[model samples]
Target chain A: MTNVLNKAINEKPVTTGMLLALMAATAYGSSQFLAKQIVTEIAPPSVVATVGLFSGFVVLMGLSIGNLPKDRKAPKKAVVFLILSGIASSAGVTFLYTALELAPVVIVAPVSSVTPLISLSLAHIFLPKMESITAKTWVGAILVVAGVSLITIGSHI
Target chain B: MTQAIIFALLAALGWGTSAIFVRLGLQNLTATPGTAISLAVGTILIGIVAVTAHGPTAFNLNPNEFAWIVLLGVLNYVLGRYLNFNSVNLAGISRSAPLLASAPLVAVAMGILIGGETINSFILLGTLSIFGGVILVATGGGRG
Candidate 1:
């Protein structure tokens, strides 16, 4: 058992990525749960957002602080894109946290999880050279819409 | 109810666009520095909003709430995002995308089990549908 586990763990990229992705899912889900805990009437979304984002930034900086110098050498265009990404990410987080403050996770999680569909569509339009989308992706989008609708109806019922 | 939906949609839009920017940035740079730079910018932006909205009163939380907030930051921002970046970097997007899509399921389960949210067949089926659809949509996007 130990040998099997060790072998699986040792596999490069594939196994490691699977483990990391799984860990990420758990962390993200748990974060939403934690956000719900603090985002009450007593502490508004903005308040919690500020504290949480600050703390997160601080922690991340500590871990990756060594890479700060490399960022300076990166192409200006890359830096600019990263800055834009940051701003957008901030907006996304603020809105999602606020939504959690207002609704149950059942509604908010699935709703916000639709980020992929929109991202893919945007990639097709803006980053067309980078990636291509197929009919299947659109079908998945339709399914996502249907699922969201059902969740809404369920919420109401 | 409407507010929640609208906010969630906006969040989706912002996050979706952010993903595009990250990709563009990655054309010239690696993920760690890119993410660090972007997150730094985001933190500053969010900081300004917090001050404008709350006027520095947000720091008065009790110990429990404070701890929860810290935990949220570390778990979501640090662990969740960092692991995700490494996942895509290592496994390629196609294989990892399906797993990342599972986040909603984890959140939903925790919400029902620990957060005391109520649910029914519609909610269950809907959640499952979205989960499947997200997997399909994300994976269907050519393997990163």
Candidate 2:
């Protein structure tokens, strides 16, 4: 993984931050399917959500403890964003699992797959530096929408 | 269809916003703390949901169900996610995204083998098409 990131960073043309963002996107996409498997066993959506968030918290905390600076204090703004992100993520995972519970795996999969599309679009509107719509993006968006539709249709049977 | 679609869209918005926030929060802290902090907040939120959704029943889970939840909490939430984030950190989004996208295909296989779900012709077509679409996206044109 670091090799890929290094390539993205050292390559004259590609920026490291952009490369990082892309990595985040890929993680987002892959998480959906793996999550689907777990969610199947832990129904009620909320249980899955709780377990996921709690476990992620525990693991991240355990690994990071020794590295903390003794005098460090979190800035108020970052704290706000952290809490907001947490709220948004909790809501997102809950809704995602709700969709999964109601619909077939195939159906839920594509619906949430629209995430990149929405995120990119919203990023264009808000974080203009992060991304902009282009012809290729349009094509990709169309394909994703079509793919999602096909999945939904296929799942009905 | 309407309800599911709406729920999914809501999920997308929440996740998208969270992604942005995760990036922002990471600016100041190390990845581990940032992930843990956000997850802790989320866990509290989920606890609220469990309480409201099941009330007293939430406390009465059977031993089997509780065990599965704990195992899943560790494996799926902690281990699976850590690997995922690490994969992104290592591979870059482009290479990583495609690998991650393979999850759906993996899910299809799991469903058949583990869930005892049968696939028809439609599933084959849909899965293939989804993969094709994802490939196009991962290559992400220089545009949005």
Candidate 3:
């Protein structure tokens, strides 16, 4: 473990990846904060969700234009799943905006951050062959759920 | 308050299930294009509804706010996602996921510092547990 940490810290690519992850986290965190500000102070949650996500779509579409043709060559089922995934992702954003509209970012973020746990369970159920769930995952899941329960309990009390 | 938590959990469910879909979809695709396709599709579903259902006047806003939203959109969905994808490829998920998972911490910090929100004891400890748990999960590893 110490060796892995030492190597990750010393290596350039690993360090770069670490930096990028931190940057992405910052962007995500800031977006939530800004979304809260926008929804609470500037506009309705629906408007904020639509405009913000639509703008993201525009940029992502531009960046990914070259790969657009690749989608067609791909299997139809893949496309369908992608579409469904997209809808779910959109719903997630909409729900998040709504939560932000109603509550503080601090409250909403901790609760919503259980996404990994959800993903783990779904992966275990749907793609058991692809995902290898360890005992550590269950341990972590329990802790996260317990934490979330506490947060909910705290909010009520 | 309960409504907010429900919505938050729903958000998690939407996001969580979407990852499975992405995993299924990506069996034949790579990250960027797959994400691009899914995001475009999602935008069409939710974004269009948010506008059309709410009427044309729903999106009314000043130039300043609009620009800020646009910038944030690019930052979070485009740049942030791009960076995360690249990081996963570079450092591997074990190294990257923990950091990526810390996004809530950043939000919590920003909430207290910039957004001027207060936190109680249970909430603080709960947040920490959630953070620690997420780190443990990420380190334990799932390919997606």
* Best by the DockQ measure: 1
Q: What is the C-alpha RMSD of each candidate to the true structure, in Å?
A: 2.7, 5.4, 4.3
Each prediction's whole-model lDDT (CA)? 0.84, 0.66, 0.84
Clashing pairs in 3: none
Pull out the clashing pairs in model 1. Answer: none
lDDT of 2 by residue, A50-116 (tens): 8666766776677888876621476767767788888997898899888867765555655565566
Winner by TM-score between candidate 3 and candidate 2 = 3
Q: Which lDDT tens digits does candidate 3 get at residues B50-69? A: 77777868777889989988
Minimal lDDT window, size 10, model 3 chain A:
A2-11
lDDT of 3 at B115: 90
Pitting candidate 1 against candidate 3, the one with the higher DockQ is 1
CAPRI band for model 3? medium
**How are the candidates ranked when ordered by DockQ, highest leading?**
1, 3, 2
* lDDT tens digits by residue: candidate 1, A1-157: 8686557657765988888899899999888877877786447787777777778777766776787776568789888998999999889999999999999998889888999999998998887777788777988998899988888788778
Please give the lDDT score for candidate 3.
Answer: 0.84
* Top-down TM-score ranking: 3, 1, 2
